[model samples]
Target: MGLCLLISCGESGKRTSVDPGTDTQDISSEESKPVNTPGKKTIVFFGNSLTAGMGLEPEESFPARVQEKIDSLDMDYKVVNAGISGETTAGGESRISWLMRDRVDIFVLELGANDGLRGIPLSETRENLQAIIDTVKNHYPDVKIVLAGMQIPPNMGPEYTAEFREIFPDLARANQAYLIPFLLEDVAGIPELNQADGIHPTVEGQRKVAQNVWEILKPIL
Candidate 1:
């Protein structure tokens, strides 16, 4: 897995996926049962370091921001940050079942960047991502999914890059999931918005990231 967690603007690097079953740091909260409450719903955000708030505090993370929004709107959803630092699609595939230890009313899938960065076979990336989706559906048949699309640098090749970018929308349509095209829309590559590593979002960037997610997510909620 070529996970570019260090610098979004520099050379790409790979890393093994963190096992969600064992790695507890990325999880925002823990629940032993199949969900939170009888009336309230649960939204499990499944992604890589980007979702984990790699370079920032858990409070400054987008997931925490989402929690604040939900609180203000008086919504009844508890967001669970099931993000893992340095995770790839395949890693997500392996860890999804564990995260699903609790029910997922909404599953936000933000992955595939590492695959594109690693220049893995597009078909493999697509298949692995599909597998992750399939796993979620297998456990929670009625769970609504929000696929947060990601993009990678063009270092791989224009054709490969284009096809990779197209993967998210394709998956969304095929899976009938909500699409938030380009999760890094206005935040990627912007120096002031990123941490020193240039990959992870700073606190300000995460706030904007929260807005980006909320725009697409609120309607779904």
Candidate 2:
């Protein structure tokens, strides 16, 4: 995943992947726009820039793609992309309460990559993530959760990177959350699949990413 995927996840505290990354990634930066039909159960994807689809168009992002997949099944499920570029577990923890305003039937957690890139303490990052989970559970007691795991380059050191990589599975096991082994999966580190930045996935790559997520999300739905 060159600088783009590296930065897309966290980018060593840099916004090089997509300068001035977008704040929230829904169907449109235009909050007023409605991507899903009304009166549907909502599935909220909450995470960082990778979840935000950094450089890709709203419809090309995985969350949006998931929406398309859901619609194709004729399901009345709405996908809400609450992705904030450059967001870390701490950032997500602080904001989880507010974002749960909707009645989320499914809450997909995609945070912590930035914390890994920034080399934040694993314990602290874990705690913040757990806090976010706790908040989500508090809000929606019956909500199904999907945790998206992320990875960083070896430059962060093998021991640290290994520990960082284990965070998601550990959280999933502890919370009984459905785990997506890796968010980027077949997309990360693939030159052609990623945008020029080497971080964010290209449209083709996003299609694969969406499929990766849908496999896990579909079963839950």
Candidate 3:
């Protein structure tokens, strides 16, 4: 499938696109300002199905909620959901260059859950994620990164589960990026928050997930 690019305009009237090879350094430097330009901050949400807002309307996804929040605050920021269902860390790495070509102020990196679910090797997942971080850093050293963590189901066994859970924090520290303890902190495993498939979150669940992400994100934004 062709890569998808989502762009939203904030009050500042600046338009952001998802084009790989864009000058991220310029974007990152601009984001560090005490106050954002009239409408310039562009936050990209990158991940798999979870970020894609599976089972929910596009506008109802967590990224959309974040956009709404920014709008409500009248912040000069736009939130773009770049999530793809069933995406693995490897897949994300392959697309990172192109996906981030546009000017991106902040990146919410969420991946690896599908890798764990598919029983992919942890080492491979780590390498893929690390590569993504390295590339982003090389392109935009000052860009703020928020690494979202995920936990594999207990059925994955203790050894694999523990290792998978550690990847996010480890990568965040290694990359000097911010960390969100758990992407699904209050939503995962909660029957009321999940859909019939039990894997994806329902609308209510996404709200909580958005809140979980927002908690860490607000401080940086």
> Given candidate 3, what's the lDDT at residue 143?
86
lDDT per residue, candidate 1, 1-221, as tens digits? 23233323222323223443344334334521235767889988887777877766777889889989999999999888776665677777766777777778999988888677777799989998999999999999999989998777778878998898899999999999999987877888788888777788889988998999999999988
**What are the clashing pairs of model 3?**
12-39, 19-101, 19-102, 20-101, 21-101, 22-101
90-117: candidate 2 lDDT, tens digit per residue: 7677667667666878889998877777
Q: What TM-score number comes out for model 3?
A: 0.82
lDDT of 3: 0.73
lDDT of 2 at 116: 79
Q: Which 10 residues in a row give candidate 3 its minimum summed lDDT?
A: 2-11
Cα RMSD for candidate 2?
4.4
Ranking by TM-score: 2, 1, 3
TM-score of each: 0.86, 0.86, 0.82
Better candidate by lDDT, 2 or 3:
2
Local accuracy of candidate 3 as per-residue lDDT tens digits, 112-216: 876787678999999999998888777878889999988877566889989988999999999889999988876766777777766677789889989998899
RMSD of each: 5.1, 4.4, 9.4
Q: Look at candidate 2 and give me any clashing residue pairs.
A: 1-189, 4-197, 4-198, 4-199, 5-198, 5-199, 7-11
